[model samples]
Every structure is written in structure tokens, then in C-alpha cells.
Target chain A: MMQRRPMIGLALMAVASCIAVAARLLVVRTLDGSLVVGWPGPTLGQFRVDAVLVACSAGAALGASGAILQTLLRNPLASPFVLGVTSGAGAGVAFASLAASIAGMAAPTGAALGAPALAGALLALGCVLLLSRRHGALDPITLILGGVIVGAIASAGSTVAEALLPPERRGLLTGWLFGRIPEVPDMGSLAACAAAALGLTGLGAAWGNRLDGAALSDDEARSIGIALGPMRTAMFIGCGVATAATVALCGPIAFVGLLAPHCARALVGARNRILVPAAAVAGAGLLTAADALRQWIDIGGGRLPLGAVTAVFGGVAFLVLLRRTAAGWMA
Target chain B: MSALRFQSPIIARGAFMFAPGEVAPSAGRVTVLIGPNGGGKTTALRAAAGMLAPEQGAILLDGAPVHTMPAAQRAARMALVAQRPEVGAPFSVRDVVALGRVLRPASPERIAHALARSGLTQLADRPFHALSGGQQQRVAVARAFAQHEPGGVLLLDEAFAAVDPPEAAALVREIRAEAAAGATVLAATHDLSVASALADDVWCIAGGRSTAFGAARELLTRAALPSLLGVAVAEAHGSRGTIAVADYGGILPEAPR
Candidate 1:
């Protein structure tokens, strides 16, 4: 009953992605009540493709990052957000805009914005890791606590930066924070995010054996010939980089990172080699599907924020998965 | 068969300081470490298993430096079963057992062989967290069995602490089988009855000291440790097969630095 299911996850991903892409391509009602439906020719197709590509890359990074984070922390509840990286990235963009206003300079966009986001994300992750070390090894409880503390502090920094922004500029940061699939995403940010997602997923799969041993106690893992320190250090860094790239591309999309792995796990079991890739595809499908859903639903207002759609739907999906697989988190 | 001999440096686990000492066990034999609680028996086994590094010197398996060996290489040569916290996730019994073969593919037949040898073949599909302590202990043994080379080293610390009499007897058979297959076994246990019957050599640790307490076959047969417990001792048996551990670390003097 517990054998590895490599192809099932792939097949499900293909089905989900194809459906999401068709939905996204076939119809779209623009914000001004102009219904653009059926066969979006070359120019429009290219735009749709770019949006889908950005969403998939960011979402894949998030899902793969979350899977590795949960394993490294040995805590089932762990996600990209738990490590404070996403919030830190938000703070970086927030403070950068605040700095730009004070300096009377135009705010950075695309790759320029991504640089600070990556820096802030990595800085926050480093602090959490540094705070959690005991005798050169990470203790799970200390790590979880450190992540929570760091995340809280980063969230506060974002709120402060947001409060200081002028009303007109504030709207841009607010819209960014609400998360969206950019129709014209900077090609460089998309490429970097995609590379990180694929790279980290491959690394996770290559180190699957060591990760499996890590599911046991520290001493036990060591006995099985796992160099716990080196493997943990490498995997943590990989996850951090992937997550940072995700934040750089998408401004803190919530729940997708946490939920996608569970969805993948439902199909792939916990063997990380297959699980990492499975989760990546699952994340891609989910975010694109969410984007497609946003286009379809109308709530007597302007287009719904991508973040709102994800948070409400993802939270509900998470609750459902949590109820079904409480055993997945057992100590 | 590998012979283990090393001078363990002064090791501190938490606030407890284990004083330095040396223990050399005969090759291809079962050597039981006997000690009072907090007397550094676990520290010794961990050091021997290369899971804990000595502050100075190395644990020599045959002539190789066990502590400095790369983890993957070390795992192919040595296996350890120590008391540990419950596994962190709901890995299947087979999944946990398959971990022992990290250096190689976890073939189903090999995993089943290890599970069957440990008397847990039927429970291979169960989640590790769902097992009783005795069954969990058996799973630990199964993991070691899966990873272990026939002529490699096996270190056990409180490995049989959770098992019932029948399971204990079954595990004893497993240990004997390992030794018979030319592996050297070092187990840290308080069960003198098990030590008495099972051990070939003995390392009696006390007051943070480890001493090579002589052959179990000779000492237990002579009933030499009758006075350690200040009680009646078992009568000598003429047969060479059965022996008792007149063994207690209390009788051994602290080793000199």
C-alpha cells in the first residue's frame, strides 16, 4: 500500500496544468467589462503564456521550498512563510519604496526590486538558522521558534514601511502585496525564479536518501552514514535560495507553499526524491488553477486580488487536507 | 571480523563527565558493556559506533580510523542501535528498515530478509509510530540488520530495553546469529542474565571509567562476581555453552588516567 507512485503525481499534474492553461487561454473578461474570448492570437497568447510561466515558476519554487523546509525543520506545519523569508522580502520592497520617496528617486521594478527581496529573504533565513543552532546542529524546536520570532519581526517591519508610504505610492505596494500573475513579468526575474525552482527540486531529489534518514533521530541518522551537518546545511541553503527567488517574483503568496506539498504527498507518499518534483508540479497546477478561477468568479466589484483568491481557497483546501491527514504530522 | 580497541577521551554528555579509559574486545565475539546508570556505558557504545567522536585518539576497527571515516563509508561497515526518540514522522516499517541500506538500493528481498530475521516481516507495512515499544525495538534491530555487513561491527545500547521475554529471546538469537556470521557485537545493557548467557567478552564501566573485565566465559563460569551483589551466586555448569554475567560494573575499580 505504501509503494512509491512516481507517475501518478506526474499524470495528475499534467491533467491539472492542461485544464488550467485551457481555461486561461479560452476566455478573459478584462477589468473594463470588455470580454476577450476565444483564440487570443499571437500577441495576446504570448502575454497569457508569460503570465502562466511566471505563476508556475513562482509556485513551483514555493512548493518545493515548503517540502524541504518541513523535512529540515522536522515540523509538518513548516512552510516558506514560517521561515520569514516571504515577509522579509516584502519588508525589503516596502523599505526600498520608502527610501526611494525620501531620496526623490523613482522606485525600482523587476530585477532591481528582486535584488533587495532576495537579500532580505536570505538575511532573515540566516538569522533563523543562526538562532537555532545547538552544538553545530539544528534543533527542531529552536528552529521553529526562531522562524516564528523572525517572521513576526519581519511582518512588523513591512507594516511600518507600509504605514510610512504616501497614498498614491502605497497603492502600488499594496497591489504587489496582494499578489498577481504579471502579464508582462520581467524576463530576468522569471528566468532566475524558474532556475531556482528546478535547481532546488533536483537537489532535494538527489539527497533523498539522507533526507529519509533524517526522518529518524539525529544519532540514528548519523549511524546510517548520513553526514547530518553538511546535508542539512546544503539543503537549508538550497531551500532558502529557492524561497527567496519565489518571493522576488511573487510578493508573498500565502498557503500555496504549505498546501501544495500536502497535495503532492497525497499522491507520492513521503519519499523525498519523487516527492520534491511531485510537489513542484502540484504547486504549479494549483497557482495557475487559482489564477484561472480568479478570472471566472465575479463578486460585484473589480477583479479580485490574486492573494485574496488564494488565501480563501487555499486556506479551505488546507483545512480539508489537515483533517484527512493529521497522521502526517505525528512525532 | 573486526576488533575494536580505543582510548576514549574524557567525554561530557550534558553535565555528566565520562572519565577517559580503554576497552579492547576480542574479534568476532559478543562483548557486553556492563555499567550502572549514568556510568558512561552509552557514551562508550556511541563512541565505538563512530556516532560520538572522542576528544583525542580514534576508535580503531581492525586498523582503520572509525571516527574519521566518511559517513557513507562508515555506514557500510558499521551499524548501531541506540535508544532514540520516536521517529519524527509516519514512515512505514519497511521505509525505516530500507534506510539501513542507504549506501545501496533497498531491494525488496533484502529488506524482507532483514525484517524476517528480526521477526517483523508481517509488520513491514505498518507505520513506525503505530508499533509497540517491543516491536519498535525489533524494527531498530531490523534496520541494523539491513545495514550491517556480515563481518562488520554492530553496536547496541539499551536496544532490548523495551522487549518482552519472548522477543528478548528472539533478539538474543539474532545477536548470536550476527556473531556467528563473524560480526563483533558490543551491547550496553544492565541485564546481567543476558550478559551472562550471551557475552563472550566484557567491558565493565563505572564511576566514568571503562575496564576490560576479562572473558565472560571464564569469569561467569567461575562465579567470581558473587560478592558484587552480596548475594548467592549461580553454581558452575560443566558445559561450555551456557554462562552467567557474575557481571556488574560495581565490582570494577575506577581506571587511572
Candidate 2:
């Protein structure tokens, strides 16, 4: 029976991935009746495909990162966004764009955006770690509070940068800030994000047993041969990198990271091996479906932001999960 | 079984310091550590298990310093069951037990045997948090048992405190069986009767120091119990056995340094 759970979860993940792909294809079919052959210019179908790819990759990254973050922090609500990685990345890009504009330079693009974003993420992570540590231990309440403070500061900085931008460019910046999926104009950036997400997810899954042991008391985990310091450091860095990559490509889409892991935990148990990948697939399916829904809504001249769609669903899921938690549904 | 030797002064944060001492747990024997609350008993056990590094001297397993050895290698040679081990997630009893196998190769037979020995076969499918405190302690015992290596060292800190008598007796039997099979088993407990009945050797700790180390029957005397526990103690002898009872003296003042 124990062995069967992982197998079932694996099957569910496969189905979810297929559904995500189908959802993307469905969006493409709706946008353009069929696939366009040669490209003199980017077709509507091509644009939809890029959106789907970015959403799925970003979703997968957030899901995997959330699983690790939750385990490390020992808090069910911990995720990339809640922990400030997304806001930090947003600040980094905004600061870089502001600097470039002041120097009368064209805005940074592609891989150029990654360095500053990663720096900002690591900085926020450091602050969270430092502020939350008390008597050589990480207190959950302090950690969350620290993350919130860092996020707020970074958000304010990003807002200030937006105010400095030219009026014509303000709409585009605001759209990104609201967590709209970016069109991956270049294949190179897409490949880089995809590779990063997959690589980090593999690393997280490989450490599953240690992660399980880590859920125990620090003394017990140490007695059981887990190098707690190294394991935690690795998890933090892996989650940070994955979150930064996603935030750099797509604006900080809230809730996919927080919601997917909880959904996976319901499907499978709390074992990190199954939970990590299952969450990844769930996130992919969720974001892909959300993007499709966004396209379907078409409320105004532009489609609704993918982030807004996910937040609504994710917000509702969060409340329900919180209620169940309050009633002692989780340990 | 491998001999465990602690030759050091161990220090635990927010706790008393263990003065320099040497503990030579005999091979194939059940060595029990008895002490008053906060007497550094847990600190000693943790040092022996390699969870706490000594500020001075060393803990040696098979004559090699445990702190110097690789973590996995050290863990392969011993298992420590903590008092009130944390169950932070909704893991099944079997899953919690399986965590013990991290240092060794996976073996279903070994896991099954451990569960049966701890009498947890019936509760293997239950979530750990759903179990009673005593049941949770038993699950910890099962996990340590599953992780046992041939002639390995097992250190348990108040592992059976929450368990009822019958189940505690069964666990004691399991510990004896392990010792007879050549494992060095060291346990800490406040229950002097259980310690005296099962231990081949007893180490009495008081005021963060080892006050006595010898045969359990000889060391756990009525005269020693009162001073060690800082209260009045009475030993009642019946046809069944001898039980040492202590009277609460309204929390005796801290022992003078």
C-alpha cells in the first residue's frame, strides 16, 4: 500500500502534464484555427505557444521550489512569493531598468536580467535568514514576518521605479508588475529557464530521503546522518534560483507555488520524493489552465492577466486549506 | 557489540555542563543511566550518539573518535531514540520507521521485524500524530530497532517514559534480546525499578557529574536513591519483586554547586 501511493501520484502527474499541454493546444486552436507553417512575422498561434511554454515552465519551477521551502521552513504557508524571492527579483529588474533609463540606455533583456534578479533574491533570502534566526534557531513566525517586511520594501522600490518610467512605458511595466505572462520573444531565454527549472527540480527530488529525515527534530535528523546545515543551505539556494528564474521570465505569479504543493500533499503524503514532482505537475497544469482561462475571458482590449486568474483560484484554495488546517486536518 | 566510550566534558546549550568523565559501556550489556531531572543524563547520551560534540576530549566507538568520522559512517554504527521525538508531518507509522533505514540499504524484512518487535504491526498504517504519546514512543523504538546494525550501539533517552507497564516490559524484553545478541544498549530513565531489573550496569548522574558506575543491583540502593533524587525514598519488597518509591518533597532546592 505504501509503494502504491507514489505510483498513483506518478500517474496523476503524467495526466496533469498532458492536460497542461492539451490546454495550451486548445488555446492555440482558439486563437488561430490551425498552426501557421512558415513565419515571416510572429503568428497568433506562435504567440500563444510562447505564453503556454513560459507559464508551464514558471509553474513547474514554483511548485518544486515551494515544496522544498515548505520543508525547510517547517511552515505549510512557505513559498517563493511568501518568502520574498519573487518580490526581490521584481525589485532587481525594476532597479536595473531604472538605471538603464537614467543612463539613456535601452532596457536590459534576456540573460542580462538574470544576474540582478538572482542577486536580489539571494539578498532577500539572506535577510530573511538573518532576521528570523534567534539563539541559533529559525522561528517560523519570525521567518514569515521577515519575509513580509523584505517583500514590502522591495515592492515599494519597484513602485518607485515604475513612477520614474515614461508615461508610454508605464502600461507595459504595470502589466508585468501585475504578473502577466511575458511573451518569450527569444528561444534562448526559454531554453535557459526550462533547463534551470528541470535541473533544480531534479536536485530537490534527489534529496527526498534527507528531506524526510529533516522533518524530524534537529537532533534526531543529525543522529540519523543527515547533514542539516548543508541540506538546508542547498534547499534555500535551489529554491531561490528556481524562483528567481521564474520571476525573471514571468512576473511573480502568486499562489501556484503555495497552492500546488498543498494540492500534491493531499494527493500524495508528505514524502518529499513524490510531493516535489507531483507539485510540479500540478503547478504546470494549474498555470496552463489559468492562462487558457485568461485567454477565454478576454474582458477588455487585452486579456486578463494570468497572475490575477491564478490569485483568485489560489486565494480560494488557501482559505479552504486554512479552514481544514484549523480543524486539524493536517498534522 | 562495539564498546562506547565517552572521554570528555560535554556541554549542551541552555543546560548544565557534564564534567570530564569516561563512560565504558560494556559490550553485550544493557547499561542504564539514572539521574534526577536536568542532571546531564540526556547530554551524556547525546554526546555518545555523536549528536553533541564535546568541548573537551572525545567519544569513541570501537576506539575511533565519533566526531571525526563521517556522519553516515557514524550513523551506520549506532542509533539514538530521543525522548519525545518530534512528528512534524502526517507520516504513517511505517513511513516514520523507514526513515531509520537512511544510513543502510533498504530491507523490508528488517523493517517488518522491527515493527513486530515493537508491537506496532497493528498500527503501522496509522498516522504518527494520531497515535497516543506512548504509542508514538513505541514507534520511535521501532524506528531505532529497524536502523540497528550488527553489534551496533543504541542510545535511548527516556524512551519508555510514556509507555504503560506491560508494553514497557515488552520493550525491555526487546532491549535485552538486542543486548544478548551483542549490541551495546545504553538507556536513560527516572524509573529506578526498571533500571535495576534490566541493567547489567548503572551510571548514576547527579549535579552534572557521574556519582557512581557499577552493577545496577549494587548501586540502586535505598540509601543512594534519596540523595540522588533529593527526596525521601522507600523500598517495598513483595513476593512479586522489589519496587523503590519516592516521596515528593515539594521540589527540593537545587543541589549546591
Candidate 3:
């Protein structure tokens, strides 16, 4: 029974992914009402493809980052957004835009924004670690509280940056801040996000066995040949880079990182090598499906924020998971 | 057997410090560290297992300082089974056991054999957290056994405390077999009878000090046991084995001049 779980999960993820792609394709129809497959006039078909790719890549990045953070923190509740990485990235991009305007330069776009965002994410990660650490250890409660505090501070900084921006750019910035996926005008940006997601996820999978050992006590993990400090540092950095890149591309899409890994754990057992990739696939499916749902919902003229859509479902899942695993946490 | 020479002063900040001591487990033999509660048994075992780096002094395995060595290299030379083993998530018994083989090459046959020896073959597919405490301890033993390298050091801290007698005996048999096959085995336990029966050499610790270290038959005497444990000890020799029983309620007698 235990062995078959991962196989079933893989099959389900594959089916869900197929459905997500099919759903996105179906959303883009030609003038005659047929589903647009090849080229549809100017940019309609291409636009949907781009949206799907960005969603898939961003979701993959968030899921892998969450898996790594959960292992490093030894807390199942850990995720990129919970750890303040997303807000930090948002603040970083806002600061960059403000700097560009002050220098009388056009606002930076596409992949050029990922570098600063990554720096901010890493800084936030470091601050959370520093604040929560007590005698070289991190308790789950302290870590979570530290993350929330840092996230709030970063969010405030981002809001101030938005206020400083020119009136014309303010609306677009506000929309992005609410977790709308930005249009990538260039293929380079899309490829960059995809590369960052895949590269970091691959690195995470390579460290999967050590991550499994890390899930035990520090003493036990060391006894099994894992250098705890170095392992945690590596995982933290990987998670930060992946999350920051995704946030730079698609704003701060929440809950996919928090939700996907738990779903994966239910499908696959806690063998990290299998779980990390499984979570990535599940995350992609989840984000794509959420996007589809957002399009279907008639929220006036504008679409609902992707973050809001995911949070509505992911929040309930988190509550259920917390209740079910409360005893495990206490233990 | 691997020669394990542990010389260190273990310091736990704001808690306790184990005074400097050197203990050498004899080659091709089982050595048991017997001590009271809060007496630094786990600290000593941790230092020897390379889990705790000594504030001063060093632990040498085969004449090399273990603390200075890379983690992987140190792990390849020793295996430690903690007193209270915990899994962060619900992993299968097989997956938990596989964690022990990190420093060594993959060997499914070795993992299977260890599981069978620990009487956990039937529970291989079960979630580790779903098992009873005794069963969990046995799973840890199985993992340690799977991790054993030729002429390596094995350190177990109260590993069999929660296990049933039959399973504990089987684990003891496995430890003895490993020692005979050229592995140095050091275990810590509060059970003096089990220690006496299993240990080729015994180190009696009290108040962070090694009060005695010698042949188990000689060091585990009624008088030595009482002095070490702060209780009256009675020994009964039967056809089965020599049993050293402790009377916990008795007050400590005055020291002999």
C-alpha cells in the first residue's frame, strides 16, 4: 500500500498537468469558435502559451523552494511566502524601479529584475534565521513569528516604493502587487525563470537523501554524514533564489508553495528525492488550474488576483493540515 | 576490530560538562558504559560518535582525530543509535533504515539482513511513526546494523531501553557478532545485568567521572555496582547467567577508608 502511493501520485499529477494545458488552450478560441492550436492571427494563441509557461515555471519554482525550506526548518508549515521571501522580492523590485526613476532611466523589465529580488530574498532569509535562532537552534514558533514580522516590514517598504512611483506606473504596480502575473514581453525572461526553477529543483533533488537524514534530530543527521550547518545554508540559498526568480516574473503568487508539498506528501511518502519533484509537478498543476478558475470567475471587468484564488483554496487546506498534524508538531 | 580512543571533555552550555576522560574500547570486544541518570553517558557516547565536538581534547579513531576529519569520513568509521530516535515525517521503515547507509555504498541485501536480524522484516513497509516505541527502537538498531562497516566503531546510547527482552537479546547478539567480526562496539545502558552479560569490558561512570573500567566480570561486582549506581546491588548466579540486581530504595553506605 505504501509503495503504490508514489506511483498513483505521479499518474495523477500527469493527468492534472495535461488537463491544465488543455484547459488553457481551450480558453483561447479562434473567430470561428474552434480551439486555437497553431498560429491564431497576431498574438492570441502565443499569449496563452506564454501565460501557461510562466504559470508552470513559477509554480514549479515555488513548490521546490517550499520543499527545501520545510526540510531545512524541520517544520511542515514552512513555505517561501511564510518565510518572507516573496515580500522581500517584491520590495526589491519596487526599490529597483524607484532607483531607475530617480536616475531618469526607464523602469527595468523582464529578467533584469531577478538579481536584486534574489538579493532581497536571501537577505530576508538570513534575517529570519538570525532573529529566530536561540543558542544555535530554531523552534518552529519563533521561526514562523520572525518570518511574519519580516514579511510585514518588507511589504510596508514595497507600499512606500509604490507611493513614490509616477502616477502612470502606479496602477500597474498596484495590480502586480496584488499578485497578477505580468506579461513577459521577451522570450529571454521566460527562459530565465524556467532555467532558475529547473536548476534549483535539480539541485534540491540531488540533496534529497541528505534532506531525508536532516528530518531527524541534528545529532542523528550528523551521525549519518550530513553537515547540518552547510546543508541548511545550501537549502536556504536554493529556496531563496528559486522563489525570488518566480516572484520577479509573476509577482507574489501565494499558497502554491504552501499547498503543493502537502498534497505531494499525501501522494508520496516522505522520501525527499521523490517528494521534491512530485511537489513541483503538483504545484504546476495547481497554479495552472487556479489560473483557469480565475478566468472562469466573472469578477467585473478585471480578473481576480492569482494569489487570492490560490489562497481561497490553499488556506482551507492549510487549516486542515495544521489540525491533522498538530500532534506531530508538539512531538 | 576498529580501535576507538575517545578522549574529550564534553561541555553542554548552561547545563553540565563531562570532565576529561579517555576510554578505549578493546579491539574485537563489546564495551558497555554504565551510569546513572544525568551522569554523562549520552554525552560520552555522543563525543565518541562524532555528534558532539569536544570543547577540549580529541576523539581518535585508528590514530586519527575524528573531529578534524570530514563528516563523511567520520561517519564512515562510526555508527550511533540515539536513545530517543525521531523521524521528522512519516517515512517507511525501509526508508528510515536506508538513511544509515549514507556514507557507504548502497546495499539492499545488507538493509534486508539488518531488518530481518532486528525482527523488523514484516514491518518494513509501515510508517516509522506508526510503530510502538519498542518497535521504533528496534528500527533504529536495524539502521545502525545496516550502517556497520568492517572494523568500524558502533556506539549505541540506551538503544535497547524500550525494546522487549527477546528483541533486546537479539540486538545484543547482533552487537556481539559485529564485535567478533572486527567492529568495536560501545553501548550505554542503565541495566547492569544486561551490561554484565553482554560487555566484554565495562566502564562504570558516576558524576561525570569514570569510576571503573576493566573486565565486565571484575568491574560489575556487587560492591562496584552499588558505588556506581548509589544503591545496594545483589548478585545471583544461576545456570542461565549471572544476574546483578539493584535495590533502588536503599541508602548509600559510607565510603570505605
lDDT of 1 by residue, B1-257 (tens): 66777755666677777764666776578888876787788888788877666666667877777777788888887898977535665578998899899767777899999999888988988888788887898999999999998888899988888888777877888898889889989898877677765788877776667543788865554355553334444543434466453433456576796
Clash count list over all predictions: 2, 0, 0
**Candidate 1 off by > 4 Å:** A1-4, A30-37, A106-112, A166-174, A321-328, B217-257
Q: What interface RMSD does every candidate have?
A: 1.8, 2.2, 1.9
Task: Looking at model 2 chain A, report the run of 10 residues with the lowest lDDT sum.
Answer: A29-38
User: Per-residue lDDT tens digits of candidate 2, residues A162-257?
Assistant: 789876555444555667666654466567668777976788788888888887777777778887766776676677777877776776788899
Candidate 1 lDDT over A54-105, as tens digits, reads 8899889888988887777676667877766877787788888889888988
Q: What's the true lDDT of residue A105 in model 3?
A: 88
Question: Which candidate model has the greater DockQ, 2 or 3?
Answer: 3
Per-residue accuracy of model 3 over A1-331 as CA lDDT, tens digit each: 6558788887887688779877865664333444444445446566677778988888888888887777767778788876678778778878888898889988776566766676677678778778877546554457679889999998899899989999766654555555655445346656777887798788878888888888877778888888877777666667766777777677778788988888888777677887888888888888888887776676555667887898888889889989987766325
What TM-score does each of the candidates earn? 0.89, 0.89, 0.87
Top candidate, metric DockQ: 1
CAPRI rating of model 2 = acceptable
What is the full ranking by DockQ, best candidate first?
1, 3, 2
